[model samples]
Target: MQLIESISKRHSPRSFDNKGIEQEKIELLIEAASWAPSAFNNQPWRFYVAEKNKNPEFYNNALNCLVDFNKSWAQTAPVLIITVVKTTYDHNNEANKFALHDLGLAIGNMMNQATVLNLFMHQMAGIKFDKFNKLLNLPQNMEPVSIIALGYLGKIEDLPAEIQKVENEKKRVRKPIEDILNYSPLK
Candidate 1:
């Protein structure tokens, strides 16, 4: 698929089919994320992939870590990918401010790749921080940034009325380039 077309078609899929994604496809999606650019090449992103049927306990635990609102629709996705990043890059460094941005780029790459592969992805931020930290056994230095739900998309009828309306509209709107870009500031 063309890059622009793929990006335009990529939307958060709230309803997913129960069918499992092929292992090869999952690997390809991760491989796409692996190549994203990082600040000074300080690649700090880590991913934890959990499948529902294979590990119900872990899946439920992770799902429970999401906010109640997210849990409603997220349960439909067959796979959940937890994205994390280590804080310290070296022994002397106490901070790395760009880790989140780097992770975002990686995730964007992953989503686009999924669209190219005829898969759907939903990146979510509504998570219960405390529960997630404890359930995932995350080290103090590693920060869990986001959760990505992956699977094949279900029919439009499966979505809530509001969401179904938006999907059916098929309109993609974004801030105009002029509004986002600036050349010079008034003195």
Candidate 2:
């Protein structure tokens, strides 16, 4: 049994090359994300991009919003994006429970596009929420989700010695499908 090459090759690495991503590729990632299905077709996902080469100051500001641990390694990535979501439906002022899920779908699409472009992405939940919210001056109805670092693979040596092997050389593993799928009664 075979899987999509991009899906199988996709991986999250802490080490990223300093080379900048081309503008066209970045637009393609966003285009893919924009097409993800959303509840009521609201398309709540919003991206705050910081390209190291194009917007260094904003890139540094975005980097500062991440926790120290993430900041340490994420700095090497050429592109950083903070995904934001609208918490309420645009047609009505009611809450949208599926906002986050929709955001995840959008990010998934973006990551798949990245893989096709030979780029890798590492999505981190280690953000300073308060700082990030304030940094972007986000509205009450919008929420910051996760920070994503995107770039080409870098030397394992660029990562801290403690995690070098773990990040770049470790074997990939996943739980068996039987462990996750409910083939029979839950009991």
Candidate 3:
């Protein structure tokens, strides 16, 4: 698929079919993420994935990290992923200012890959990161960035009433380039 096509198709879905995705597809998503460019080649992105159908324990562990509102919808997903970024460079233990940015790039790549495969990924920052850190036993250099709910598209009506209206009515909007672009730096 083309870049624009993938970008246009990509959406953070709130509804998901509770079916197991093939392992190959999961590997493809990770492989796509691995291709993202990073500063000094210090790729700091890490993904912790749990397939609900295959491993209920792992999936429940991930679900416990989400806020209640998110858990209500996210529990239906086949996969939940915890994304993390290494905040420091391994060499000299220097701060990596672009760590999060690099992680975002990796996620962007994965989103496009998912779109190409007719899958959906919904990412949220409403996670209790400390819970994830405690449960996953994260090293000092790593930190939870976001939680992603992933699966195939499901009936919008499957969502809770409050969210169903949003699914039915919401439209994707983008700010015009003119509104964001500035030729000169403003003081």
Model 2 pairs whose backbones collide: none
- For model 1 the local lDDT of residue 187 reads 62
Model 3 has a clash total of 0
**On residues 86-106, what C-alpha lDDT tens digit does candidate 1 reach at each position?**
787654567878888888888
lDDT of 2 by residue, 1-187 (tens): 9999889999898889999999999999999999999999999999999999999999999999899888888998999998999999999979999999999999999989999999999999999888888877888999989899999999889888766756756777899998998968987
Residue 158 lDDT (model 3): 87
User: Estimated TM-score per prediction?
Assistant: 0.88, 0.94, 0.93
Instruction: Judge candidate 2 against the unseen true structure and give its global Cα lDDT, from 0 to 1.
Output: 0.92
Clashes of each: 0, 0, 0
Q: Where does candidate 1 stray beyond 4 Å?
A: 1-3, 159-172
Model 1 is weakest, by summed lDDT over 10 consecutive residues, at: 86-95
Worst ten-residue run, lDDT, model 2? 161-170
Ranking of all candidate structures by their TM-score, best first:
2, 3, 1
Residue 29 local lDDT, model 1? 91
Writing each residue's lDDT as its tens digit, candidate 3 over 77-118 gives: 999988998999977689999999999999999999999999
Full-model lDDT for every candidate: 0.84, 0.92, 0.90
Q: How far is candidate 3 from the true structure (C-alpha RMSD, Å)?
A: 1.9
